[model samples]
Target chain A: MVSRRGFLQGGAIGVAGSAIGATSGSLVANALNNTAAETATAKRQLPFYGKHQMGIETPIQAVTNLVAFDLKPETDRSSMLRWMTLLTDDIARLSRGEPVLADPAPELAIGPAGFSAYVGLGKSMFIKLGMESDIPAGFIDLPAFKMDQLEEKFSGGDVVIHVAADDPIALSHATRSLVRDSIPFASVRWTQSGFAHTPGVVKSGVTHRNLMGQIDGTANPQLNSDDFASVVWMDQGPEWAVGGTQMVFRRIAMQLDTWDQLGTKSKEEVIGRKLASGAPLTGTLETDAPDFAARLPNGLSVIPDFAHIRRAAPEAFKERIFRRPFSYEAGISESGSVDVGLLWCSYQANIEEQFLPIQRRLEEFDLLNKWTVPVGSATFFIPKGPEPDSVIAQALFS
Target chain B: MKKIAVLLASVLLLAGCAPAGQVEISDAWVKSGEMSVEGGMTAVYGTITNNTDKEVTFVGGETAIAGLVEVHEMAMIDGEMKMQRIEGGLVIPAGESAVLEPGGNHLMLMQLTGDLMAGDMISVKFDFEGADSITLDSVMAKPAEGGDESYHETEMDMSN
Candidate 1:
């Protein structure tokens, strides 16, 4: 599978090379000159500008905040344009390791720290702004599943800003800066902060574990590959979404107490993957394809019928989603249970075709459901990235 | 069904520890289990410190809210998570504590008599192998906290 980190490494080099190439010669030779200037600074910086938004395919950061905002009752299209313009300026400065023009805490924004921000729109935003026609055909809210126990707190918002960085200080600063900038046009709807492995805890290229201790993101589409481009980036949506994707943010709460009852062997049977190595029951390595038909002496399937992978994996080749989930631990419930779970985030070219079919299968009868519950949910149409001198969502507003 | 039957019959004993004092519970509380149009389930969590020199086994528990108050565990199985009743008793070693927090090991309250709301206190009796059962009253409150249980709107000003 194409790893997100490897993809960003390649992106960083290309971006740095192009920055130098810009001053050299012909477009093709500037590309050559760009290669000559590969330096330490270039490797550390992720390109701020691209055809697609940066955060979607960027390597998972050490810390992140997924925040949504509801438009103020009197805010209109002009107010939205102003909000986007200011947000665009702030992002451009921060992505380049600088502070916003009028930043109150310039010190907090000193290091870019691999910062990237993705902005998206909700269905309500379209209706309120009288741009319902621009809402992409694939941008509808997720249909309710039988297993969903959604609460309104973590649910709806008109706009979402997914900000992340390798440093918690940088990520936190950016989150505040953006939200502060947004206050005039919108009210805070909800905000969820989460993390993965601290920068160096895991070996490079390894998948991160969820709160449940399962190695996740193993079956994701190869980042920056042709398959990923086709499966995640939009081509048939409104012009604004040409290189964008649909996003789903669901806050799933894990029932850790009940989950503790199972033995290691029983746990293995539930997920069809080994806890220690994250490999399939019929395979020894994490990357080996599962042998679904392999059975035991009693002729039972090696991976049970209701195993999560069996249901989550689709029979149709094109039905797939790029899951980029982050583990969240807000606090403790009144009962002293940990308020922990995955900020279940995913992106795909089309929600109706790529994501729903698989979720439907899991909802029907995945053994995993017994210990995990979906308490919050929302969907957004992430607009394509901004070009230099232009703002995010510019294509849609224009 | 087969798994439950096998687990129920399985009994475990802790080999070492102080043989006196028995098991004790602390910080015991409950979140009012919501029973909206969709059915709901609530849980009880606390610290069970084994005071005796010998290990004590948790066989099960009883409560009036549900027809059955079984001890259940939740963990990642086959890359997916699952919660199941302990067929064999959960063993607590002497001098050590078995902390029942949400998402780990706790009392699974099912078939509630009515919606468990905040300010409500319910009674439950815990059964142990080496000592007599102890009944305690637990208070129910909202899951997590803040206005109407919303995380973002209530916590916007809080630092990440």
Candidate 2:
């Protein structure tokens, strides 16, 4: 029988060998096992230090642990600084395949697997720290929506830590390390774990389908493009917040049982996209601009006015957001219904200018809203990436 | 000539030639504890690097919040895991590090003067043999897991 230790050692060797093979510009000629190639892809390491936080612009990983923390009553600015420093140290070490300080299970940290951690501060944090005046321009609490069934348990927090990795074990270890270091200054408000396709399971740049089986985020700006920078990174915020962005997080629960009852044609009309290709009703390609004014034989618009894509479309040049979302399944609900949904996360330079307008339009009238409910909502300001040896949001403390 | 060369080598070693550094600590933290009617206890964990040529021994430590401190290890006694105080100090080889971690070796603090709540920081001065005492500010934290019950039990197997 193959021992656990032997299997682990073999996996590690396979990963290293595959990495060397890939870098040598030669097709791996069946010499390395398939498990080794897949393992190497899963073990890709993302640099922790950069112009912006790693997870925001970096491609989404396979698994995510989104944890929110509410600061303790006794926590003050100085204590918060210490907490940030400790968390920052942990992130830097864990992202590079090293164990955090005093880690009880250092062995679990061996596989970084494209690990990245993004830190964000909620509006309540400013009030708690007595820095409300320094809150970035256009960063505010999201207005209550008409379709919201918001629960306090998953609604708000003083701080948010978003950690992701392609490997679940690596993600779990990193998440635990950060949460362990945080309890000293804060209490956990909520934790939501979500996931996507494994690293090598799908082609690299394809849009992911949500729980509803509809291709999501097809309208998102291309990564690293100038359009992405304008839509996702702030340039006119407070000096300390420059290069940072605003995030709107919502837990949108899907009513799939009822949604499945609708006819395919009706579903297509509701979303205004083809089920097979995600292309607009009036276009053959997913990237084609939808011809909103096209008419059919009955003199009705091909893309229905109440369609989700039509309603969510930007009316002006600046009304846009960069979406990076994940799918979540929490098993069955207490009522014996399947519990699954989308953890919708969007980044924008200015929430007021970009995100709110589209959301308001959707709230006013979107056919797809009948099958989706906003159950939890929160907003945060993700500060710029920290320099080497510095903690996240160090300028706030100064 | 041989005697003169030996004396020269001894002089060089005594004149700070042995790595030329002092002991340092990093990632130091203390587990949170409450002060009940009886008392309170916690443990400190971190990495201690000995940079000097001679081996350094961590004898004990002093903190304003704790009345007593000692080096401890978790060992199996009578087929059960038990906490025990190391009679001799924990030693670190020259230019090497000794990790004080949970479920392993650590520094125990007992008879706390007050509650060591989360978000609080306490100063600890570590006494060492063949080195100067180093003071560090350790944050009080409550880890999610990792043998936390042993620290709270307060029963030490001193039979050894």
The lDDT leader among the candidates is: 2
CA lDDT, every prediction?
Answer: 0.75, 0.82
Model 1 stretches astray by more than 4 angstroms: A1-43, A333-335, B1-160
Once fitted onto the true fold, the runs of candidate 2 whose alpha carbons sit more than 4 angstroms away are A1-32, A333-336, B1-44, B47-88, B92-97, B107-160
DockQ of every candidate structure: 0.01, 0.16
Q: Candidate 2 local accuracy as lDDT?
A: 0.82
Best-matching candidate per DockQ: 2
Query: Considering every candidate listed, which one attains the maximal TM-score?
Result: 2
The sequence of per-residue lDDT tens digits that candidate 1 reaches over residues A1-398 is: 76899989989988989877875548767576556532222234577677898887766776789889999998887667667766776687678777554344768865777688989899999999999888887788898988889999899889999998877888888888788777767889999888877655675332688878788777888778888888889988677789899998889999988887899888888889998889998899888889898999999999999888898987898798888888899888788889889888889988888888898899998999999999999999888888764678876775
DockQ of predicted model 1: 0.01
Worst 10 residues of 2 chain A by lDDT: A25-34
Error of 2 at A169 (Å): 2.7
Chain A TM-score for each candidate, in the given order? 0.87, 0.90
TM-score of each: 0.63, 0.77
